[model samples]
Target: MATIFTRIINREIPGHIIAEDDRFIAILDINPLVMGHTLVIPKEEVDYIFDLDEKTLGDLMLFAQKVGLAVEQAVPCLRIGISVIGLEVPHTHVHLIPMNSMGDINFSRPKMNPSGDELSAMAEKIRSFL
Candidate 1:
């Protein structure tokens, strides 16, 4: 079965995409930790981040860096925090979270439930910077 991220990448399900290239895709986290929390994922569905080959891992960070810059600009934040907790979903992904304080990246904290319109607007704002 395709993972949810794969489904989104394949356009089998809807996603608020922020950016994409031939190898990777950036999309808004539906259950966001902050206003501009986004996920950077490779087109290939690898189950673990460490399991990716050297070149793919390096490319993934470069891709995430580009997306992070846009997320930082689109959303007000002191900096963008990166996290790689892959337990929630099987596919490898990088979380680019806009952070004003330490608590902003706390996964233990409850996630924000923004409306669809809010996510769409945020996605547009991020795409504008990319």
Candidate 2:
């Protein structure tokens, strides 16, 4: 079965895409910790980030670097923080979250509720940075 991320990449599900290339995809997180929170995922459906092959792993990070730079350019943040906790979805992924402090990256903290329109606008803003 395709993971949700793969489904999103395949257009079986809706996603506010920030950027994409042959190896990876970037999209807005629906339940974001912050407004510009994005997920970077590999095209191959590897369940664990650590389990990815060396080449793919390196490629994923390089792809994420570009997305992170765009997130920084488009969003107001001290920096873009990356987290790779694979438990949320079986597919390996990285969370490129916009943060002003360490507290902004805490998953246990309450997530912000951004409207659909707000998400759409933010997605476009980030896309423009791409």
lDDT (CA) per prediction: 0.96, 0.93
Residue-by-residue lDDT tens digits, candidate 2, 5-45? 99999999998988898889999999999889999999889
Q: Which candidate number maximizes TM-score?
A: 1
Whole-model lDDT, candidate 1?
0.96
99, model 2: CA deviation in Å?
1.0
> What is the overall TM-score of model 1 with all chains considered together?
0.98
Candidate 1 Cα misplacement greater than 4 A, ranges: none
In candidate 1, what are the lDDT values of residues 1-130, reduced to their tens digit?
9999999999999999999999999999999999999999999999999999999999999999999999989998999999999998999999999999999999999999999999999999999998
Error of 1 at 92 (Å): 0.3
